[model samples]
Each structure stands twice: as C-alpha cells, then as structure tokens.
Target: MAVLSLKKSNLPSVWLFSFQVIFLALFVGLKFQTGYDWPIYEAHYAAIQRGESFYLDFEFGYEWIVQVASRVGLAFEQFSAVVSVLEVAFIAIAVRHFFPRYCLVVMAVMYSVPDFYLIPTFSLLRQGLAVSIFLIGVCKVFSGKKISGLVYFTIACSLHYSVIGGVFLLGLVYIFPLSRMTFSLIFAAAVVLYVASFDIIRGVVEVLIVYVDPKYMIYLDRDVFNASFAYRAAFAVVSLVIFTCIYSAWMRRESSDGDHFDRGFGLLSYRLALLGVLIPLIIFGFPTLSTRYQYFFAIFVIGCSLGALQYVNYASRIMVVAVIAVTAYLPFYRFLSSPLSIVYIPYQSQLFYDQTNSTGHDRTNDLLNQLDVLWSK
Candidate 1:
C-alpha cells in the first residue's frame, strides 16, 4: 500500500530528486575516462598548446570555450570538473521544474548509466556544449516555449550539426499536436518500411551519405553499419513497435506540470526513434556521429526509464536496483588504487593524432599532466 501510494504521487518530490542527481555526478566523475571522444579532446587541447591561432585552426565556438578557460588561468582538469558540475546542475534544475519529486531519481539514474557518462565527455567542447544546450532546449520545449526551443536548437546546430537529431523533434512539436492513434499509425508505418523495403530508406541514406556535409558523418562508415545491418534492422523494428505502444500511452497519461502533454509526446517519439536507430548502429559497431548521437539518445533513455519506474512492479524494481548497485561499484573498484583513472584513456592502443608526430597530442598531455601534478602538489 505504501509503495503504491508513493508510485501514485505525480508531482516531483525534491528530496528524491536531489539525492539522485548528486549520486549521478559522483558516479560519472569517477568513471570520467570512459568516453571515446576523450582522445579527440586531447588532440584539440594539443592544438591550443601549440601557438596555433584557435579560431583560425578550429571552429570559433569551441575555440572560444578553450580560449576563455585558458585566459581565466583554469587548468584542463579544473575546466573538465566545472563542465561536469554545470551539466549536472543544468539538467537537475530542468528536471526539478518538471518533475520535482522524482528529479533526483532521474539525475541519479542519468549519471549511474554508462551511456550518460560517455556522451558529454566526448569531445568536451562543441559536441558536449551542444548536448548540454540540447537538454536545456528540451526543458524549454516541454514548457511549451516553441520559439525558445528553436533558438536553443539553432545554437546547438551551430556548434554541431549532428545535434540536429533534436531538430526533427522540435519541428514535429511545432507542427503536430499529440494524438495516440496517429502516433501509433506512424510508428507502424516506420516498422513496415523498415522491414519490407529498407532499400528505399537505404537509398535516401545513400544520398545523404554522398551529398550531406562531411562533419555530420564525423565517424560514420557504411561498411561498419552494414556488417550488423540485419540484426540491427530487426531490433529497430521490434523496439519501434514496443516503444511506440508504451510511450504513446505514457505521454497521454503523464500529468507533470511545466511539461506540455503534446510536447512530451513528441519528445518521447523522438527518443523512440533514436532507440530504433541505435539498435542497428550499435550492432554494426558504428556510433553514428561519434558520441553526439548516443549521448543525446541516452538522455531520453534515462528520462524515460525514471518516468517508467514510477509504475514499475516489485520484481522489475528490484532488478533495476540491482543494476544500479553493480554499476555504482564498478568505478570504486576500478579506481580505488588508481586515482589516476580519472584521466585514464579508454583506448590506449590506437593513439589519436599520434603522440610522437603530433605536437597537439604532446601539449594536450602536458596540460593534462600539469593538472594532475598541480592537484597532487
């Protein structure tokens, strides 16, 4: 009865939300070296280490972040810490406004998941900035401020066009009001298209692959995605069918204030779409758009999972609790003896920008090393 009553409570509870967000921050901070994008960041830091003009060599937006942090005399580690904290705080504030009671739980779950930790740490500049802003943009959209949402999306696109996965959602929200039947129909159509004649979709994808801007595909490879294409395609169809049914109903049922029903529906639909796409991409071992795609999608996973936990049964809830417990322990065990794991590279074999030949790589390491040395001193 008590559990049922707690589950029935709709509004966000402050205590639950606060505790969760803190847990998420600490957990991610511990496993900080796991993102694939970290190497790219190192390379960028290396560039700054050289006397190369930042805006001239790199995108102005990212250059500005690095330049400003350097001008303020902040170390790389310190800058990383600040960004992590800001990401947590920004997302927590948004969650609190929309789901106050459960915001901490959402925050905790977000950080506790490996996917969340990996995304923001990727690049640590433009992509990370876009992701952080995307979260803020999501909050604005949910609050029914369409114009604000567009502006937020535009900023993200300016930083990384790959973040435009978010734009599909924003445009949908602006154009279509929520309707259960229509959503279900569209989902069904997507599944059918995915199953019956993916060639059609593939052809369109090929066109985009050939003609679209190169930056958008950053790390995309047709050969890689094609390898596990069948399995991924099957999973995409199944996930779409399942997610469509579950999220469509949940969108209709959710009563959270500061979150418009229609907008929430669109966002969840976008999330389901992302999941549908990720299923195949992961199997193919191709992270679409590097870390940006997975990072944004993981946000939806965390949010939706927390929202679903509200109605979770005892058996499933216990399973989720177990997963969290195990994930929470991993970083502690991995890093207890090696506090240096904070900056440990996830991949050591394939060096980015080849340290010996690349001045950028050397200087980036020097900067990171300085931070470690200074902190220890």
Candidate 2:
C-alpha cells in the first residue's frame, strides 16, 4: 500500500476530490424519481411496507434486504441512494490503491456514461449494486487479489444470478494467455459461433437454455428486436476504437517501464471491448434478451473504456476530459431523442420540487438550504 504524503497530494487529487463531491451529490440525490422501473420499485416498496410477501420472483438476498429496510420505514429514495453510495464507494476503494491516476476517471465514467448510469443506477437497482460489486471484484482480480475478487463475485452472484454466466466467460477470458494470437482466436471463434446459420444457432440456444434460469427462458423468442441492433453494433465499434487506442498506449508504456506497469487491466479492457461487440450480436434478435443482457455490457463498455482512459493521452493529459465527453454523448443523445427517453429524462430532485410546482423560487437556493440536511441524513 502507498503512504499518503502532502507532497504527493497535488492538484490532480484536489480536482478529483472536488469532482467526487459533486458527482456523488448528483448521483445520490434522487427524490422520488418517476421513470423507468420506478413504478415497479415503488410498488415493491409499498408491498414490503404493507407486510406483503413480494419479490419472491427475484433474488432472495436482495428481496430480504429491501424488505427489512422497508419494514424499518426508510424513504425509498434515500435507501436507493444508499445503494448508489455503496456502488461508488466500492469502486473508489478498489481504484484508490491500484489505479490512482485513473480512479477519478473511472468513477466519473462509471457514473456519467449515459447508458451505464441510465441502465444501472436509474433502472436495474439490485443489479446495479451487484455490478458495482462485480467491478470492484474485477479490479481486485486484475490486481492479483483473487481471493478478494472471489468474495465480491460471490456476493454479486447471490444478488443476481442472471449475470453469473457472463462472469464465467470473463474468467475464462482472463485465465487464457494474454497474447495477441490467443485473443484473436477467441474473438474470431466467438464471432463465428454467434453469426453461424440459424439451425446451428438454435442448437446452441437450446444448450444455453438448460443452464439459464427458467424464469428468463420466456424471453427466448427471436423476433422481439430490430434496428436497435445496429445502434448497439455501432456503439461496440466506438468502444473498440477507444479501447484499442488506450491499449496501444499501455503497451508502449509497459515496454518502456517493464514490470512496473500493470498491463493486465489493459488486456481486460480490450477483451471487454470485444465482448461489447459480441453481446449485441448474440442478443440482437430478441428485445427481451437484449435488455436482459444490457446491464452487463453497459458496465463492460463503460468500465473498460474508463480504465483505458488512464493510458490514453489525447491532447496530452486532457484525455480524461475527452473521454468523459465521448462517454456521455451517446447516452445523452438517447436520453433526449429515444422513444425510451422517459426512462432517464426529466431529472428529479427535491431541490426542484418547489419550482416544478410553480412556487417561483430558486432551485439552487433550495438545494443549498437542504445541503446540510442532505449531508446530515
């Protein structure tokens, strides 16, 4: 572990600290938001409060946690925000030791990237917590702390067994030789298997069906999606480009710096970059399946891209800003224009409550006044 020193605590850390403060507040400040799956969450919270047996359909651990909290009468918004806080805290803790230079960048992308935030933080609540834990576990694994990684992975699996298959695949990829030839073969083979004829694909799907939870089997129909496949495909290509650039830079640095540079994360980044491509293709034919898997891939792309941003040097150290901008563009565009924009648009907060009701007062002032309350709570 590295020791803290005032000499080492410089401008970048100060800037990152400021960014963390603002980002944490923005992310965790939801005040009864009304969008994508909020109705479902509200219903569940209500049921829990009313002492009804619910969420029996989902993971037991998550269900129990929410039920217990609801029994104690916590506000849903505040409780959900606590989950977000844990998500950020875990990631920050992992990166603080391993990727100090890029911790803020990773945290920034993990929160700000549109699809990443929209899907996990705003919609897939339990899975959001799981994925955050999963990423922390991944960081530990890549940092050579396999035992710690296993602990995190185990907790995540308990929350959402749905993504355990993807995690298995990631483990397989990671244990394989970290060479260009091996990666090429894996990527090519995955693409071939995914793009094969319908009969062959059907056989593969049948095999996967047996292993998948029976609950998700209802989403197996192949006719539930279209055009959006192209969108995900394009996003994958963009991710690939960004990852490759960062990876190439990392390789150069590793060659110069020898064992001092940890390049495994770079390798992991590109591997996920490829998965970003493969997942869209594999799930494209079914909207249900696509959405079921969206949470995993969104994390892959955002986490990988943000990790890579550490090695990237666009405009010579302005790369973080560039990466942040690029990370936000797609999600922001979708937030405004997509048919599903209702899932993420119309940002909500108690600060805006008065203004939203035409009270004719300053939202900023309201927010400022409530800051002490917010922090104290």
Candidate 3:
C-alpha cells in the first residue's frame, strides 16, 4: 500500500499524504464541537438534493463524481463525508506526485485557508466535488498533461460555474510569459480591481434587483465576507513583489534550457496562481460580492499556493526538514487562536473554538441542527 511505502523511499509524498489524512479526518470528526461553517455546507446539501444548480456562468464537470459518491452511500452526509475525505486525499496524492518538493507547502496552503475546512464541514456536495476535480487538473498540469488538465478543469466547471475562473486562469498560462512587465500589469490591475470591487458589486446588485425582489438582497449578506480588509490587499501587493523577485532570481540561476513545456504551459499555471490572489481581493473588498468572490479565491489559492511552493528553497534535501516544519507550523500558529480558529475558518479549528462564547455556541448549534436535518432528509 502507498501508506506502507513511507519506510522505503523517504519521499515527501508520505508526509503530504499523512498531513491530509490527519487534517481532513480531524475536520470531519470535529464538526460539531468546532463550530465551523457547517451550516453553509448543510444548506448546500439541500440545494443539491433539490437540484438547484450552482451558478450558471460556468459548468462543473464533476457532477458525476458528486452523484456517484452520494448515491453510493445510504445517507447524504455519509456520501459528502466520503467525497470530502477523498478530495483532501486526492490533492495530497497530486502534490506528492508532481510537486514533490512542495508537497508540504500545498498542505499548508490548503489547511491555512479557513474555508477549506468550512466547505466540507456541512457537506457542500457539488462544490466539494468541483474542488476535487480542480485538484485533478492541477495534477495534470504539473505532470505535463495539458489535455488531461483541460478535461479535468472542464469537469470541475460543470460541477460549479465558479470554477470557470480556474479554467480562465489556466488558459492564461498559455498566453504571455511571466515577466516584470506582466507582473506590473497584474499588480496594477489588482489595485484597480480592489478599489473597484464596490462599484462592480453595485452594478451586479442593480442587475439582480431588476429581476428579483429587493428583499432577496439578504441572501447576499453573510459573515464570511465581513473579514475583507486592507491587510488582504497589502498581502496581495507583497505576494506580487515576492513572486516577481523569486521568478527573476530563479530565471537568472537556471543553467539549462529546462523543459520548454514546463516554462511554456507552466505560464498558465503561474497566471492561475496570480489570478487566485487578485480575484479574491475584488470579491472580498466589497461586502456585497464577498461570498461569491470567496468561492473563486478558494479555488485560486490552491493553485497559487502550489505554484508558490516551487520557487522556495526546498530544492535542496537539507532544507526539507525546515520546509515541513515551517509549512506545518505556519497554519497552526496563524490560525489556532481567537478570530483565527479553524472552527470559523475551516482547517484551523483548534484556535477557532478556543475562544468560543455563547454566540459561537449558538451558531455552531444552529449549523449542526441544519446539517442533521439535511442529512436526515
């Protein structure tokens, strides 16, 4: 078995696999006590059962994956649990297989995002499958299988239209090469998009109001989007600078032609990574577009984190220990506290529930109840 092979190769794949299993297991087991956003997932289950498709702007090709997994089990939650666990596992495998040196980094990124935990908590049926499909595409891209990557991405889009952002970003990889000028344009565009998110949201709201009643506006309101701040924007700017510098330095250090394909198709992967950061800013900067934007950001972050990990110092064997330690601890330290807990966040529950109060208790309870109802039905 792959798990037993850990004693043989000493590959980083073992570590990545171990992390996903432990983290995802904890996420599944601690749903109630942690008070993660189980309610949203629970609602998603209901939506799927009722056949209310995800946004029509794109397609999610993994509809069969969700249905098959869901149908294989006796209960909805059981199926959701199975699919969710598989997602973490699949991504883990992909990370190990393609980006071996950055395996731990991929785990760290996935776990660091609070929503990663939340999505599976209540059981987001289609979206969960969509995420899994997206990871499949990532694996394909890194493994030098562009056709398969496109197919997987298409599957993801059919499951959730939001995944179209991923497809578009992936397509960008085929366009211009990553350069100082491209970085400048991206940074400038991020700034403009961040500032204009409000206007964009207003326009969207007006368009929606024309079709639906104004009272339905409450549907757009949620706590998840409330956390958007100037710090996020600052982080984007910093990441852009860091990535640009890293790419420049890495390019300078390279001695060989390397793989024309890696550098060529890898351009799309890099673009996808950048879009992952920028799209979130536009979505979260304005409260109205926060929830929808988060979906995009979540997908984007997974790709961005994977790409970013490659440029780090882990190319040397001596740095592997430090890489694992840093990747593992970063999520725990940054997210395992009040307002940063995984309960509210997703993968960092140890912190989220630590600072729990009556309100947290009630919210958690409400979400659990809803989840139970959806599963029972």
Note the residue pairs that clash in candidate 1.
12-100, 12-101, 13-100, 13-101, 13-102, 17-104, 20-108, 46-360
Candidate 1: tens digits of C-alpha lDDT, residues 73-172? 7655456556666666666776565555445454555554444554454334466667777768867877778689778877777666666775674455
Query: How good is model 3 by TM-score?
Result: 0.61
Could you give candidate 2's per-residue lDDT for residues 82-194 as a string of tens digits? 77667656656654544555555555555665555666666677777887688788777877899998998888877788658758767766676356455456545544444
Per-residue lDDT of candidate 3, residues 128-157 (tens digit): 567667778877876679899889887777
Candidate 3: 10-residue stretch with minimal lDDT = 1-10
Candidate order (TM-score): 2, 1, 3
Ranking by lDDT: 2, 1, 3
Model 2 scores worst on lDDT over the 10 consecutive residues at 1-10
Model 1 TM-score relative to the real fold: 0.63
Q: How many clashing residue pairs appear in each of the predictions shown?
A: 8, 0, 19
lDDT of each: 0.52, 0.57, 0.51
Model 1 poorest 10 in a row by lDDT: 346-355
